[model samples]
Target: MEGALERSLRVFSGRGVLRTEYWDATIERFHLVSVPPDTAYQIGYTGTEPLWIGAWSSVGGDEITDESTLEPAARPEGNAEFDRIMATRSDRDLATSPGYDGEYDADPDEDRPEPVVTSFANTAAKLCPKAPEVGCNADRLAWIAELPELEWFSDSTVMKLDPGMYASTHTHFENEGPHEEIYWVMAGKARLITEYRDARLRRFDCAFFPTGNPHGIGNVGTETLWIGAWGARGGIEGDFDIANLDVADRPGQIEEYERVMAARKQRGLPLPPNADILDP
Candidate 1:
């Protein structure tokens, strides 16, 4: 049984399309599928308890143009901050954790750079200097300064808010397109209020704000909360360094707001009072 189980997860190197098989012990059969190049697949259960699989590919034509066959371009080496973060990481922390494994391309044509890594223990929290006047009542721990290879996203920060605190009411704007952003609750509850919608989010909950959407969030629960925010890069090149937000785009609310004050307002639209979190 152990040998069969080990073989079930084994991977081999090959070119062109790849095939994978899932062994369903309940029915004693294998579900086989082919994965095209430059495509990805995942298997999981739906909310209704039905098994499902999904496949996705990049937009445009079926084939993606390969990188130049000539010498690969020089990639950006680690900066001072990147070096410092790497220095603080211990070997044990970099090692693969138990109960997790993945297959990798053994050899590739293009030059691949080493991944930059860090932990919260190696970083410190600082007062968010961007929009104190806008009532963004939270401390920010930035991650983008040390990760330059992250080309698409401009800002990545883990924000911490105490109970009864409210974030800024502003829209992140980009000259070329609407600034897309995602907020994922890491440790607490959040009430995300935007121009068109207001949602209460719990741990593991995520919300996406499309371009031109003005939004603000608050710590609605009694305990301290933490949320991870990532926004698409746009506008002037140097603007990315700052939290390029149009604070005046919307009216500001109180510095701190209780859940009861927010509940009094209508639920469909953005809340006037700041507020959410999970327990149990």
Candidate 2:
């Protein structure tokens, strides 16, 4: 018989969750640089219900191996440190924090439940600068994982892609994958192409790629692209191509790809372009 995690991944393999609202999302933006375009990082959680949803994989400095299927990294010993940093925050504050918006508890008069807080600061700190930009591209990026808070459902992180960069095409179906991928576009533009579907994405859009599927995202415009992504296990998987990716990837990446395309067509804009054929 299959184990619990395996059972769950099998159940959620084909699902895709896209952001439906903008103003209602709980998102916090940050940066490591002290200059303009400090828009280098963002973290948010929008859970896809029913499934024990969560994330990992695709873009990171390190290649996540199948071992991730064993389970999330052991919780590091920085809960106290993270608690101290967040101690000033109350349940009310958590209710209003990024990732909790539009998700208020049923009874406002009832005492709000405290959010489960997990810290990956230990791991994050370990990936810090080895010397001012000498051997450290990872440090420039913001990352959060070991989110015990999400019940090992997923690990979340952000990727900052510059214009013209073509993300390596890969499937995160190995263990930590089998994850239904989710992308929240915080800034800029890109073309997301799967073997069957392709779409042009822009600011505030979002995208969903099923586990085990092959896809490529390339920044096709002139600005930096900040994508907030997550992976959760559960849902239907298939080969049908989803058209009209602009609305979804930028903020409205949605289930109705055709509807989104119609509006774009009415506006005289071209259909989403093909994925970049960059030299590997």
Candidate 3:
């Protein structure tokens, strides 16, 4: 059997779409997603705080050949906090174990950057509960990437929507008709509805929303729905940025939410508490 580390390196080239699950020195709980075409990967992770993120991109959509001098290391260079965290890594961190055999070192010359933890725990922990508070329709949410650390994408994050919370029907930047986005149900179940389509998203099921589309997601399962969301090379992407959302046309969504609340009321169920704020 091929070792997990070797197998990951074998297919982790900067060409095409590559997906693998890794339990390295810096990663704890993890989930990744992305869009297609040029290639993208969104990862949700918890680990030592990192100072920079590394990723690969082709110079002109061809093979990644550029000044990307990033070498492959279990964690970013010069992160003492990360080193401390890894020292106490759980037994589940198999790749870092002494007996594991999978390993790959980047060719000293190619030095292509690879996909990183698109999401970070330190920042994720600081995000407001309402991912897009203004236009969203949900009352309760457990989201992970309000402000992710990446180069090509923005407003990308993951959320675990409990039964009572929902993603309000809205578009990216509202009237700004074009946005590319990805939503994947990593675990549990969810019901996603877009301007033109709606379906139940089960484990590993994903829905892609191209530009100029509207969509929303909510948990329809008994357990919390773990969702992985991402976007590609567009939108408001900066070191610490969140997209500007417009709520002018959100009354319709509010009306729809009222209906759900009414149903909860009819069944003698209280609406989930709506108070969520970033701490001061």
Q: Would you give me the overall lDDT of model 2?
A: 0.39
lDDT of 3: 0.42
Q: Write model 2 residue lDDT over 1-280, tens digit each, in one string.
A: 1112211111121222221111122221321111011011113344454322232333122344444344222334223222322322333353233333343323333222222222223325212221211111122344544233333245455566666654434454444334566776666787775545567787656777765565556677778776666555433222221111111232212323344345446765444422233321
Cα lDDT tens digits, model 3, 1-280, are 1111100111111222222222232333332322222221223334334222222121212344222334323234423322332333332242233432333332222222334433234434322345343234554434444323333444455566676456655544333323466776766777775534446678767787765455677776778777766554443332322343223233344454455445546766434333121110
State the lDDT at 179 in candidate 2. Answer: 57
Q: Rate residue 190 of model 1 by lDDT.
A: 78
CA lDDT of each candidate? 0.41, 0.39, 0.42
Which candidate achieves the best TM-score against the true structure?
1
TM-score of 2: 0.40
Go through the candidates in order and give the clash count of each: 3, 22, 3
Q: Residue 261, candidate 3: how far off, in angstroms?
A: 16
